[model samples]
Target: TGACLEKKRAHDREIHLHEQVEKNYARLQELEGQRDGLTYMIVHDLRTPLCSLISGLQTLPAMGELGADQCEVLEIALAGGETLLGMVNSLLDVEKMESGAMKLDYTLLDASELITCAISQVSDLVLAGDLTLVRALDSDLPFFEGDEDKLRRTLVNLLGNAIKFTPAGGTITAAAHAGEDKQSLIFSVSDTGEGIPEEDFERIFDKFGQVSSRQGGRLMSTGLGLTFCKLAVEAHGGKISASNAPGQGSTLSFNVPIKPVQTIAV
Candidate 1:
């Protein structure tokens, strides 16, 4: 009876691991962040040219009457090149943001615009996974002072994580509401997925903190992601947090000053 019970528990754990792994981001942001390394330098140097090459390849299909075989090869090249370029850029962003070296360009920007741009970027990914994307914008919200680019990046990361974590037919909602104090805005990204354990609410946001999906094997942790999100929000006199949602899934929310009193360094 004891042995049978243990076997049943092991089976249940395996099923849970499969679900978590399925929810993981397929975009593969697992780039090793090794600055001052030859590999990093090479990828750094290749980004610009690879981007240019991808662009050029994109134009060829439209500009010329190429054979089907030739067009297929071009398509493959474009896909592979873009993947490499994305990884290169991801590493750079993580390194710069983590080091607190990148300067922010502060502006009084419409939160609506920031939110829309981010949704647009991640919408295709959400759809590809057959997940529903929901948006809830606070009406007549006051304009906030912050870097549009950085804010958009933060939104993208949050939404991207949602898209990656939710399974087919699941819902991922991005919502915002103004603070009662009239000095801040609250933003949230919630998804229907394997919810976080109550104890991990704080640890997940720590740098390099990891979650394993299966035994003796590891699933890429969301630790680096929460780390980056926390830093980005805090850099603007804001605070970020994570918690389990009702029924299932996790909600990551952050509060930002409506008008950031601390000037963001250019």
Candidate 2:
């Protein structure tokens, strides 16, 4: 009788502990949801004013001719504003993507043109950073049907990351080629920066994930860029990954199907 009573008490305690754990987990999820909602609202609100500021900056040159010094300063200001606006837009899109509220706008897109446009967008930044931009695109990349804007932004985000971590004189390469399957195309951005740690290969794509390195120091990122890239790529029925050789550099790559099995509207 004593042994049976003891066993019963132990079982009761175990059940109580399990219940407590479940309660704590639920509470944590609720808190995280609330935080995400607040963030989405704030970031969404920032878009309008940011657009107005960028518009005014754009019109400044057209308003009148400016001195060289003033023009250079204005250019820097506009660049900064545009960069900030991009980050804000990324935050909103990430939220929409996570919530399955975003839709993919499929279009007939030229792979080479997409690569060239993406490179052009960040050419100025690449030059300013004293980095060399290498284009390794295959001459015969086939035309694909996908969301052009999302794909372009994905490339830009990868290049931006490379530019941020890469030191002056480093080379950043944008490459694209037909996948062996011929049903997909592979695109990659590689940088000769302090390579990412093996442990961070997956985590770097997580929301708000940041990688710290001995040589380059902590990455200065809000960490949403790669998350957005991952979601965008996956939405097109594709996958993304990161890899690097020790002491060499890192590459972030993704593949897109020539035609998605299904156009996802989420």
Candidate 3:
């Protein structure tokens, strides 16, 4: 009886040790997950400082005379830096929007002007892509209330994608008109590049959603660009949508009321 009692005690001890080991293993997994998340956050936050560095580097060329080759190298570096900064800012902006930390500076403005400004920012991109630009903004379009800066960014994002996706010799159109109700303005950026698949229509607007370059196939997508557009439009109490026509191309558009429900004078 004594020997049997001793064996039972030994078995209980082994079971306790096994349970403790499992608990420690789970805790280690949790810590590793936290570490990964922290690392991702650190990498994203690094963009702001890098952008500032690139901006500083950009001024160096203008500050002093340099050899033509040196200047060219500096320019190339600056351009790449600017692109990196853009991605970082895009990711940070997504975080801000998701956390409800963004506030719009709404004002009464001409919406077409926003479109034109957006096109101007990407004019070089269009030229680089060897794509033709077609502008058909309605002349009689009425003024609308919106955040000019946000709307400008939205147009830039759409036009940028259009330019990236459209092939050489293809055309991109920036068109706007009055909505069916005549109380809202509708804007679209259509590109004759690799069009989006029908199944991705809804998913494209999601956070970190599937986004491909105009070159097609899946590239590394932070998915913040279109998500930013959707949020900006909704902030104005507007709706955004996406669609692709058969063998034509893809069109991304948004509609905002002629007068936003809430507006402030600038």
TM agreement with the true structure for every prediction:
0.73, 0.92, 0.78
How do the residues 1-266 of candidate 1 rate in per-residue lDDT, one tens digit apiece? 99999999999999999887866643233433342355547767887888788889888868979998997898789768876775577566556666567777788888878888999988768878998888899888888888787678788878877776677999999988899898899989999977666666787777556654323445556635566677778888898888886767989899889877565432
By lDDT, rank the candidates, best first: 2, 3, 1
List the global CA lDDT of all models.
0.77, 0.91, 0.82
Superior by lDDT: candidate 2 or candidate 3: 2
Clash pairs of candidate 2?
A: 100-266, 102-266
- Model 3 off-target regions past 4 Å? 1-48, 211-222, 262-266
Error of 2 at 76 (Å): 2.6
Total clashes, candidate 3?
1
Best-matching candidate per TM-score: 2
State how far residue 261 of model 2 sits from its true place (Å): 2.7
Cα lDDT of model 2 by residue, 1-266, tens digit:
99999999999999999999999999999999999999999999999999999999999989999999999999899989988998899999999999999999999999889989999999988999999999998888899999999999999999998998899999999999999999999999999988888888888899889787856465644378899999999999999999996776999999999987684656
Error of model 3, residue 61, in angstroms: 1.4
Candidate 3 residue lDDT tens string, 90-204: 7667666655677877688887788888889999888888989999988898887778988899899888878867889999999999999998999999988778877777788
